[model samples]
Target: MVKRALISVSDKTGIVDFAKELQGMGVEIISTGGTYKTLNDAGIKVINISDITGFPECLDGRVKTLHPKVHGGLLAMRSNPDHMKQIAELGIEPIDMVIINLYPFKQTILKENVELHDAIENIDIGGPTMLRAAAKNYQDVSVIVDPSDYIKVIEELKSSKDVSLKTKFKLAYKVFEHTCHYDTLIAKYLREKIGEDNFPETMTLTFEKVQDMRYGENPHQKAVFYKEVGANKGCITSAKQLHGKELSYNNINDANGALELLKEFSEPTVVAVKHANPCGVASSDDIYDAYVKAYEADPVSIFGGIIAANREIDIKTAEEINKIFVEIIIAPSFTDEAMAVLSKKKNIRIMQLENIGAPVPEGSYDMKKVAGGLLVQNVNRECVNKEEIKFVTEKRPDEKQIEELLFAMKVVKHTKSNGIVVAKGKQTLGVGPGQTNRIMAAKIAIEYGGERTKGAVLASDAFFPFPDCVEAAAAAGIKAIIQPGGSMNDQASIDECNKHGIAMIFTGMRHFKH
Candidate 1:
């Protein structure tokens, strides 16, 4: 039976009614500070913490419940005679139940320009200590940290006059999980403020559950979505879904790829991604023209793909989008007429991200999970520095072709390796991604581009290993080429480019997306 219950909470959502129910069952309530006043004002009989501990809540209410009387009562085991005898000799009654929630450290830190002292002040010391003690002796004590679990405890107590061991064990598990997440948040915040090393010896990351998906990448796998602790405004997790049933794993993956590529341009741009690879990309003076150019880039491959736009989507863009079966449409904003047209397709996912133009925050990590280890590196922020680009060929590219080459480099930067992109007029005509070899990738892009390859420029994510890629591009009548030029066989490819009068620039940087 729950004879004596201690209640100290930062979140008092249903504490009043819960305390009243416990009091009606003849269970004495012990509270401190605000919780004590809240219960006492509600006309429920309650004992103050100072009365039970014989010590005032000193140190600005920090030393309220960090006493032997509180922890001893909670930790004492009823089944052990020595434990009962020791507590009895000290005149400490057993605490059968504990209700607590920690201070809002996350919310406090999330505030705009919050000070370190204010954030440190909001960290709860006694709350986690009390929760751990009660949870350790869960066989004899019921610990409730979440308000949502109040009805479960109430229902169990009303029927059997006690919380079941199974429920107690589950609640104890939750306490450990909650405390772990809380400690991680505090540690991460302090580490950022203190300017500690980015990658420590022992790294710990915490994320909050967003939702449980129906399946993972495939139907047979189970999966769930979790958002990072402080996800940036530019991230896909920050997008607000206005229409559609729910986002699947593949949908999120492909949409994120499109968004990352779309952030590369400041002008009105549209990016199409299929299976986590860019199928088409384009930039224009207006969003409608960008969408049209992007769609026309690869009309066949873009079917059912994800489209991301940097500007507001209007009715004309929505009408053109409605002509095809698109998996998702993500933009900064959607006009009312655009939404009305897009909403007609009930299966299309519409995501509106307000800060879609924000670049990736500095010092963010790009991580990949491998079989027995993890790979972590800084995110790829730059495609290439314009001043660092070298005109390596005998024939130099014109100013317009240089701009077009830069635009193609941006598209190829996000493509999966081995990657090659054929582009003209600031639009990708063909993108060959994830091929086995460089020449194969080049051949694929040339074949897909066909007649368009006659005057278009080509961009490679990495250096060419041989003259085969240049020979293929020359045969396809490629006007110019851009790639990183660190290969041991770089002279061979450069000689071939010069032999064919094809202008080639060495960016001195490789964007290899494996």
Candidate 2:
């Protein structure tokens, strides 16, 4: 039977009704501080922790419930005869339930210019201890941390004056999980404040589910979307879907890819992504011109792709975008007329990313999961300046071609491995991603470029393993090439470029997105 229940929380939502329901079920309620005052004001009979422990709250409410009497009642095993006898003789009542949620440490640190002392003070020491004690003795005491479970617990008690062992076990697991995450956030923040690297001896990742996705990569597999607990603003996870249908699994993935690539540019740029690879990317002074150029680059591959822009979308741009069947459109902002035009398409998901103008967080991890473990690597934010280029052929690219080559290099960096991008000026003409062989990728990009290949510059994500790709590019009329140039056969490619009278540059850096 749940004869006694302890309640304490920082978020006081719905606690009064919960306490009243517990009281009506013949469960004596014991609370502390704000919770006790709120429950008493609501006319719910309660015993303060000071009364229960026979000690006043000290150290600014930090030492309220850390006494042996409280933890002893929570940790004692009811199944042991000696334990029950000792508690009975010592006038200690068995605590049948413990309700606790830690202080808002995460929220406290979010405030700008918050003092380190204030942040440290918000970290609750006694709450996690009590939670651990009760969870360790879950076989004897029921524990609740989430207020959503209150009604269910009350129903269970009203039915039989007790909750099932299965429920208790589940609640115990949640208690441990919650406390572990709390500690991880506190530890990570402190470490980062001291300018330490993210990788420690032991690492624990924490996330919370945002929603159940429509489906996984395929329609049959079950999938859900989760966001980091302390994720910063300006990413797709924090984007607001202003209109259109619910986001599918593929929509979220492809949209995130588009946003990550879009972060590379601060100009009025439009990026069209298909299957997580950019099919078209263009930048111009006018947003409409940017969208049109990007769309014209590869209208075929962008049939059902996601598109994003760094600038506020205008009506003229929306009119051009509405001509295509896009799955999603995201931008910093959209004009009212632009939204009205785009809203005509009921199935297109439209989102506004408030941080489209903000800078990406430096040195964050791009993590992936595997069968037995996880793979963690720093997010690639590397870029090549004009001084970093190594012009290594008899011929050298002019100022205009060099500018175009750099633009294509940025596009290639965000593409998958064995990727190639062909471009002229500021607009991308073609991109080949995820090809098993370099020759095939070169051919795909050159073919996609068509007549545009005559004076186009090509950017390779990695070094050319053989001279065949350089031969293929020259045969297709590619004017210049930029690559990492780290292969043992670098001389072969340079010889091929010189033999064909083509200009080539080595960046000394590779960008393999996969």
Candidate 3:
């Protein structure tokens, strides 16, 4: 029997009708501040918090619900004789139902140019306290934090004359989850404002679920997509799906790889990714040419892969893309004519990201989950420092070869460890990723490049331990090589490059993406 109900909410959706229903059931309503005014204006019988607390709402209405009467009514166990006697002696009525939602701290902080004081003021203290109190005694109390539960509670009350104990327990669990999410947002915002960058001893991250996928990377595994807190403008998570079926787990994973590699270039570029590794990449004067070059880079491997472009996709690009089978195409924008042509495929996912080239925000962390733990590090934002590059070979690379080497380096940086990228004319001819040995990776890339390996450049994510990789590149007629160059036997690889008259540059930085 919910005789006394407390209703205080920052979101007033469906509150009037809900309070009216409670009033009709002879349940007294206790509210405070804006909620009280809204209910009173609507002509619903309501008692202000001060009326029940016997204390005026001092400290700008902050002290209204902090009184003993409000909590004692909510926390007292009705079935306990001692609890009943204590509340009876103190003249505190048991509050059987509590409906509350916290202040809009997230919305307030999201406002442009919001001040520290404004965000701090929006944090609700009394609301969480009352919710937790009511939820703790859920066996004797029915608490509702979400307005969507109002109709269900009303339906139950109408039939069974009370909220079921199972429903009350679920609602109690929701209160703790809601409060934890709220507090995490506040903590993250404050930490950013105060310039705290170091990882905390204990970290609590909150993400909103975007969708539940039919399955994960494999059909047997369950999976879901979650969006990080705050605005993410350029990433695949922020992209608007324009056509095709819901994104599968594999589609999202491969598309994210293409997007990350695509952002490395400011020029019109197209990146084709398969299984979270770039299969082909190219940059040209226009999107159409970029797509053609990227397709030609590896026509066989790019079939049913993800294509990501930095510029708006035009009709010319779309028509060429439609000739092949691709799982996804994501770009800054797409022309109406291009969309019409792409939509003919029916199943290819088309995504539009207006800010597709936005840089990764500072202090962003890249996290990977492992068994029983998580690996956290800063995002790999650097490809190379051009001025710091060391020409280790006697034959320095020409300006054209230098550009090609740098281009390949950027692609290799995003590839898995023991990775090798072979390129020519700002396009990747072949990529060998996730190999156990450097020599094997070089051989694989060279074999894939085939006839194109002549005059092409090679980029390794890390230094070669021996001269075997350089020897293999020389045999394939590779003109230049770029690597981090921190190996103990670096001289052997440099000597091999010198012997073959191949130009080699040491970037002094390793990018091992395991």
Candidate 4:
């Protein structure tokens, strides 16, 4: 039996050489528009897809490969006698392999000033159809969706004269995954244009498997990393873990928190993260001093926490970090001597992330997982400045208190919902995060603050929502409060603050993280 293959692609990387290699193995090559031209131009004999299907490409080449001849060739089962009889009667040859990639929808949308019509035009139809058809007949046909697979396919054909059954099955799985991800990007883009939040009754999500981790948050559960199947940079999924044990679920979560918090500061900064929340964060004149102060802020919590820095790690910082059993350390770069010192601890993960200080997208969304579903919302990008804040009490905050309030606001924005953070100067006195009730979070913050919160300014990520939080802060001797002021019972909170003679300010912005 003579083998036949179909090739269609928008990205033409290494296609000419691959097709030539297939031709050398006496495999008939069938290809559509641009791919046919490129392969022929490169001195490779190829049959145009129209010739094979006996139909000219119409509707500006969109209807070329949708015909039954192409799909029937791909989907027909080689082992079934009836399917073979039908193929012989129809004069259709079996397509043993398919190589295809979709139109560049992701790249088209990312261009500057891209019109909607251009984006819609980039949505592929026939390519994904052919991929699915070939994938469905994996018992007889092999499919290739990525250009990187060409070398391996060629090598296997050279050795065995045909791809192995295991290789065909794996490639078929990749084909399905590719089309699913392609359709997902198209749907998400079109939905956004129509101003619809709730997509059609049906939901289809696609993520490419990035890695299989050693385990989940604990050692028992299994976990894997999947990245959004599109061009996305500066995301936690794209980060490179240079060295150490495989990351756990909790490690990735804490690393994301540490990176997000580090992005907010322009100066050399260090943040110690524990349980997906910042245990201590500080900025100083030097990166080493910043790490020292942040670590000292809560030495007990910093024992096995993840640390991130905006500057390169030096020998001095490595020496200090080596004293503790930290799980991970991330920085923009590391001195050769510094890495040499830290490399002694084989289990500690070290990452060199370039451009750690670059500004992220201005208006990204935040997603949280619930029991049965996910909640998505626009991120709170509001920053509290002195001019935007309105003090609502007789006793005004001193200059030092005002500075501390600003510092506290930065930390609180990164905390979970119902979060309260107390700070004196640049050091955090106490942080109570990820609670169900505002008062409970406030009580935890105060208890952690202990005697240290006496004159510290308190920052709430959102409004009080009740007067109980104000009472708790006053009882802890907190002198001032800064929060968004939109709750319906705002007066009760104001009344409590006035009675206690505590200064309060409203920035007219809310930061809720659930």
Candidate 5:
């Protein structure tokens, strides 16, 4: 018996050539709508789905592939005697292969001024149904969901007369993944339209496998990268590694964190990230000065950390970067001469993430994973101004201290929970992040700052729960403090600062980074 293959696609690229290859292998080609037209126009033997079902597409083409004949051919198990008998009795031909691609719902909605009706219309129903049915019978039928798989399928057919079971299983998995992602995009859009935060009780997330790393964070664990389904503008995952070694799990994590921190600054900036925390960061008139000040902020921690710059890397900056044993370097662009110099370090992963500084849309949520659940909250993108700050102390912070306070606030916004940043002038003197208590974070910052903490201003991402943090800051010779004054013990903290003769200001905005 001749094997039957079904081909239904919205994207018709290389469809004719693929169908011809299947025809040469004695496989009957069945297609619908534009696929059938394209195959026939190319002088390839094709059987339209309407001819097999004896029914023209109805309901404005939405009811085309919902017929039993198409589904039965796709879902039947060839090894089951009862199924084979039923197929024969019902005149249902076995579909040996299924090639399908869904409509571009994401692209449709991405267009400027797109209407809701057009977006809803682009949501594919029959395509996913066909793919799922075909995938479910992977043991008997081969499923191809991507156009890139066509050539491989043709090659396998020409060589062995049939695709392998492993290849079929992989393709089946891909089909399910593709359909799941398509449905997710549609569902997310619909949910957003209705203004509902509660999603379906059963949640499904789909991400495409981007790469398989050599190992995970350590040598023992295994890991791979999966890009979330959508157009990710300015995402580190979408960046191109122009040169250097393959990125490790830690490298990608640090690089992503560095990029996120750098994205907040419009000016030329450099951020040094270590263990997913910003060890040092500075914005300067030039990229070289930015790198110099950022590196000088904490030379010890900057030794093996990731460095991200918003400006193009030049020879002067590259020379300064080469002095350290940096793990990863990311920038918008790099001069050819700079690349040549940096290439000497084979272990350094260099990435060119052009336009990575694009402003992100407001009201985005940040997610963190715990043992059994996740915590989600809105991102801290609030703008701060000096006039909005309330100086609650007699000794108010000077103008220079206000500038440092704002800069420290920006740095603290990117740190983990219980973050405290101390800065004097425009340089980050010390950063104590990811502590269990604010006082402990303050102590760490003071210890790290050493002599530099004498005249520096402290910026707390959140409000002080008690006056203990303020006492710690005063003991470290900190002259001023900036925080979101919302604590019930705010008066106690204010009294402690007044007794210590330290200046304190409230910005009325919290900057929790965790």
Candidate 6:
């Protein structure tokens, strides 16, 4: 039976009624500061914690409920004869229940211009201490941290005059989980304030499961999607699915790839991804024109793929996209007519990413799981402009060729390793990703591009090992090329470009998406 309960909560919702129910059952209530006032105003009999401790609340209300009287009451195990004797000699009354919620540390710090001292002051001390003590001695004491659990707890107590040990254990575990998550957020916030923003020695991450996927990449594997805790702003993970069926594992993966590549461009752009690889990408003044160019890049590879556009979707773009058997389409917005037309296809998933135009915030990390461990690194968001490029060939590329060359490089960075991209003007002619050899990448891109390869600019994620890629580009009528200059045979590749009279530029930054 819960004879005495302690209530000190920052969130006062439903506390008065809960205390009334406890008082009706002949349970004594001891509260602190705001909680006491709220309960007293509601005409509920609540003993002030300071009155019970026989000491006044000091230190701007920070040191309340830390007295020996309170802790001794919560920690004295009733089952142990010696423990009961010690508590009786010490004049400590056993506290059977603890009701508390920590101070609003997250809320206070999240406000604009919140000072460090203010955030520090908001971190509850006595609350967590009392909670931990009560949870540890749950065999004798019942702990309540969440107000939502009040109704069920009250019903259980009314039904049996005591809660079962199973229920007590579950509530005890909840306190540890709650405190662990609270401490992690506080640690992460303080670490960012200092200079240890990158990675901490004892780092903590939190995630909330979004949904269970139909399966993994294959039919036999199980899969679930988890969204980063408090992640509600950018990226596909935060996107709202506007229409269609539930997202499969492959669909979400490819959609994320398409969205990342789509963010690389500020202009009206469209990117088509297949098997987590970009098969088509293009940018233009008109979104419809961009979609047309991207789809034409590799029509065969784009079939049953994911399409992500940087700009709003119009009726024309939707009509053209509807011609293909695409699995997903994600963009900023869509016209009523476009949605009406596309809604006919029941299986095509459509997502609206509101922050598609906004840049990704700083301190974002890319992570992957490995055997018995995980790999974490900063996202590869750097892109070189015209000033960062070095003209490597004797024949320099013209301004138009330079513009197209940069566009191709943006698409290449999003592709898998050993990737090659051929682009003309603002449109991608062909994309070759995940090849065993660089030369094979070039040949695949050229073959897929067909006649469109003529007068197009080519971009490679990394430097060419030999002149074979250059030779293949020359045969395909690729007028200019852009690649990182890091290979020992870089001079050989440069010499090959000179021999073919092809213009080449080096970015120095290599984007290897393995």
What is the Å distance of residue 399 in model 4 from its true position?
4.4
Clash count, one per candidate: 0, 0, 0, 0, 0, 0
lDDT scores for all predictions? 0.93, 0.89, 0.93, 0.84, 0.86, 0.89
Predicted candidate 1 versus true structure: per-residue lDDT over 1-514, tens digit per residue: 9999999998999999999999989999999999999999999999999999999989998789988999999999999999999999999899999999999999999898899999999999999999999999999999999999999999999999999999999999999999999999998887777664488777777899989999999999999998887747878999999998799999998988888998899999999999999988999999999999999999999999999999999999999999999999999999999999999998899999999988886657788989988888888998899889999999999999999999999999999999999999999988999998999999888888889888899999999989999999999999999999999999999999999999999999999999
TM-score of each: 0.98, 0.97, 0.98, 0.80, 0.88, 0.92
Task: For candidate 5, give the lDDT of residue 425.
Answer: 59
Q: Model 2 lDDT vs. the true structure? A: 0.89
lDDT of candidate 3 over 1-514, digit per residue (tens): 8889999999999999999998998889999999999999999989998888778998887678988898999999988999999999999989999999999999998788999999999999999999999999999999999999999999999888899999999999999999999999998887787775768888888888999999999999999999887768798889999999999999988888888888899999999999889999999999999999999999999999999999999999999999999999999999999999999988999999999999876767899999999899889999999989999989999999999999999999989888999999999998999999988889888988999999999999999999999999999999999999999999999899999999999999999998
Residue 354's lDDT within candidate 5 is: 85
Can you list the residue pairs that collide in candidate 1? none
Where model 3 places Cα greater than 4 Å from the true spot, the runs are none
lDDT tens digits, residue span 1-514, model 4: 3299898999999898899899988999999889988998999889999898889999998899998789889888989999999989998888989999999998898787899999989999898889999999988898999999999989899988888889989999988778877888888777667764453566666677888988888889899977765435555666677788877788888988888888778788898999988888887888899899788777888899999999999999999999999999989889999999998999999987786765555434566779998766665555776577888777777787787788788888888878999877576777889998888888887887789888888999998778999999999898899898888999999999999989888988777776
Tens-place lDDT per residue, model 5, 87-110, is: 889988888898889888988977
Better of 3 and 5 by TM-score: 3
- Best of the two (2, 3) by TM-score: 3
Error of 5 at 398 (Å): 3.2
Query: How well does candidate 6 match the true structure in TM-score terms?
Result: 0.92
User: Model 5 scores what on Cα lDDT?
Assistant: 0.86
Determine the backbone clash count of candidate 4: 0
- lDDT, residue 474, model 3: 96
Residue range 195-219, candidate 2, lDDT tens digits: 7446676678777799998789998
